[model samples]
Target: MRTLFIAIASVLLAGMTIMSCEEKDDFVPTLLLDVQDAIQVSNRGGEFSIDVLSNLSWEANTTANWITLEESTGEKGKRALSFSVTENENDERSSTITVHSQEGTQAELTVVQESGLTLNIFVKEGAEGSGKSWEDPTNLSNALKLAITGSSIFIAEGHHTPMNIVSGGNSDDPRDRTFEVASNMTLIGGFPAQASSGATPDPDAYPTILSGELSDGNNSYHVVTISAPQSDEEQVVLRGLTISDGQADGSKSSATIQGRDFRREYGGGLIIGGSRVVLENCAVKNNTSDKYVAGVYVFDEAEVTILHSKLNNNASKSNGGGLWANNSTVFAYHSEFNENSGGTAPAVHAYPNAEIYLFNSEIRDNKGRSFGAAFYARADSKGALVNCLVTGNESTSSNGGGGVMMYDNCEMEIISTTITENTIKGPGGGVYRRKGENILSIYNSIISGNTQKEGTMNIDVYESDADPAKILASTSGEVVFDANGQIEEDAAFKAISMLGDDFTPIGDDNPALTYGMTPNHLKEIDYLFPESEKDWLDQDFHGHDRSGSTTMGATLPE
Candidate 1:
């Protein structure tokens, strides 16, 4: 009995030893996660994924879950994480995997998106007794070249001494001869980093101040030639510069290019080529071309955007004295076009093929010789004005538009805007729509106190033709207004009144502000204004509660 028991016990012990050895052979090492280093990302929007490496098993049950990956601290609060494998390699000895995560979204990886390569230009008084009393502008050329290689160029605050650099480079290199401003490259000048005491005051405060000068040879040779070598999609941006005095054709200037015409010379500020460009926070003033140009000129194939800028006191012989868009696409936001004088439309002149959009802007105090005193659109030109103020503009034409003139099947949409106090010498004082099919859309807008020195009504469409039938009432069309079913004829003003040259419209306890649907265009946009608080909708200038139950345009009276 004892011998049998010992033999059985020995057999049992041997079987147990073999079982332990098999378990040891099957054991898989688990990888440990370190807590310190981790990936970072931006918290702007969207979910991020993170991958963790593991060699234990291929089963989904063995894979790490979100809860296991998350780490929380008493002071730091809860952490969120999602996991995904970007790249993976499976092997018995080692497995590698790239993991992505939104874990520390607020904790972003260090990224520097340099707005652009900058050209810092410092212009100071020339050295005394050096005979260089006249500051040479050649340095600007060199700096411009260097800046062109990069993204953008900034011309520091300083008066540019008189010097002419005809853009045409060496005769051999035609491309070089043509001073080409490439895509995504900006040329900025006279932009104050911070408010300065003695620098040029804000044009809003003082409109008559002469802030910029150009002394190069007095001929019209393209001073600033804006072009986009790339396709139209990739646009170049130019802003914050004061450009003037550069001639298009003159003795000291380069040979006249095809677009160059002293009488028809384009932009005194910028000659826009076939490109989609943006100009922001700038001043296009004191620029001139004899024929059909103005402070800012847009050609047939160009698409331009101007925001938060000033086009003031510019002169042109023919078209737009302030801004001209000839068969182009243009958009202006939160801008001021004021005190400009020209032969045709003074503030803005658009040809038939042009499509223009104006929002939260002001066009006032402009003088024109021919027709449109404040704004002009002709030949199938389509324009939309939203939350804008158009007033105090004058026209010299026998049939003129103090506020706006549309001809040749032109279409216009005006919404929640104040078009008042405009004067025209001719028939259609406030607005003139000629033989062309003109469509006007006015909604939640104010049209009062407009003068047509000799025209029909405060807001007149057809001049000589007194046919009320011909008068195109402000309606929906190629022109459209967002009334949200609440359209008003007239709201009596209370105690508010217009004051000073500013003439900023004051809101009363009118139904327009209290009960109105904010224009649809203003509702959907990314507002990028420079403000500390981010309460208003993106790109909306009218300080209102955007997320409220009721929709409205621009201003929301408290």
Candidate 2:
């Protein structure tokens, strides 16, 4: 009986081993992907693959419809599975693709793609079709409405008035007519429609104009309004266009003042609020306003940059015939302000807490009835003028500062600049500093050829004592003279005419030619206040390099 039991046990053990071998042969497989998390793709959309390390029948599925696999179901064994995605035209997008095996094992692959590029719109003169191309162009007003963010509007040469503008109130009132600019859009003018490739467009030759003319006898409105807030990453550019013949009467309502019965009229040419605007190689001229800021008004935290532009022949009833900055920051580089007339500040007016930076610019032939024919820095404001020219400005009334005026608590710095040929009827033909802790620093500059009927020729610091020695002693920095600098002498400028193309001063004998001192004080100020270098001191008015040897005035003697 024991021998028979041992035989049965041996047979049972052999059968059990054979059954285990058979079970191992029929084992189910699992899915294993090389990359289970993320895969980056290009913006134009392309094919990509993932390694599938498994011996099983697997099926693939995508969470987003933009992703598609080459084969939905496949028998994989260490093979690369191909997949493709469509082009991402909008923002950045992501998708997930899952591979499932028969054994219930799953792996996911996340795909990411970047956004596409922006669109470009075209506009040509006398073209009456769609604005998609140069051959079929549209009007300026239509293009403005059709433009979205990340769009470029290229305008050809023509006189472009505000056509079919949306009225602010009444359609018959010219003050209600408004032309608006969208955020993150660029308007580039002065281009010939049929220009050859690699050829630079000359703004003088093309001459695109934005005129504010109405046929119905209504001529009282701001020509352009930039009220859109732009992202910090991108700037809204208005370039190579002439803005002219704008008239802003008091018919339109604005922000109410405390003492005034009605809101003040402002910005006959352009009005900017809560926006980031850049004006490059443009012209603003022949504009008039009843109250303030006939040329351009920047208010309510707007940041404006004017580069290689011109503001001329603008008139205002109150202040800032060229530009008025109220609670805003303005940067003027290689620009010109001329023949602007205002009641207070003819060229520029910076209000309380406003910051004004003038670099390599020219302010000339401006007339102010009260104060600061060139510039006015109000209480608590800050101003810097570097390598600038302030000449031929007149302050007719008894206020002060034919070149520049600084009120109580205002701080100003002038470096490598020339303030000459200015006339004031009362005080400070070159510069005026009001009482109460005002700071004025001058270095490597020329303050000559200035005249005042009542007070000083170069600088006047107002106080009860009004002593020249006390005033010079109380100044913040060294008010030293430049090389060959003359005080109250004739600048000896030749052919300083107001003709169309003869505005520049001539003659090699002019003291302003090579009288500038090196801008060492700018480096010192930069070290003391690192943030002050935003007002550039490395270039002249005509975009010429200002190296060790610099010229005093705005331009090289030519």
The prediction achieving the highest lDDT against the true structure is 2
What is the lDDT for 523 in model 2?
Answer: 57
Q: Write the per-residue lDDT of candidate 2 for residues 1-558, one digit (tens) a residue.
A: 223434544554455445546776665455556553675554567677766655567888987888888978877555668988887678778988888898898888788665555567787765666888776778887877666555788888887777654323455555555566744679988888674333345789999888776666555467777755444666689999888877777544753211111222788898887679999999999999877789988887778999999999999887779988888899888899999999899898998678888888889999988978898999788887877888899988887888889987787877666677788897888888886777777755556557876535477778755433222101111233344332323333232331113223345554444445444534544421236563465655565666675455444444
Off by over 4 Å in 2: 1-117, 164-172, 193-200, 255-264, 465-517, 526-558
Question: Per-residue alpha-carbon lDDT of model 1 for 416-435, expressed as tens digits?
Answer: 55676787877555567787
Residue 50 in model 1: shift from native, Å?
49
lDDT of each: 0.51, 0.70
Models 1 onward score TM values of 0.59, 0.68
Give candidate 1 regions above 4 Å deviation. 1-138, 147-150, 161-184, 190-221, 230-233, 247-264, 453-455, 463-558
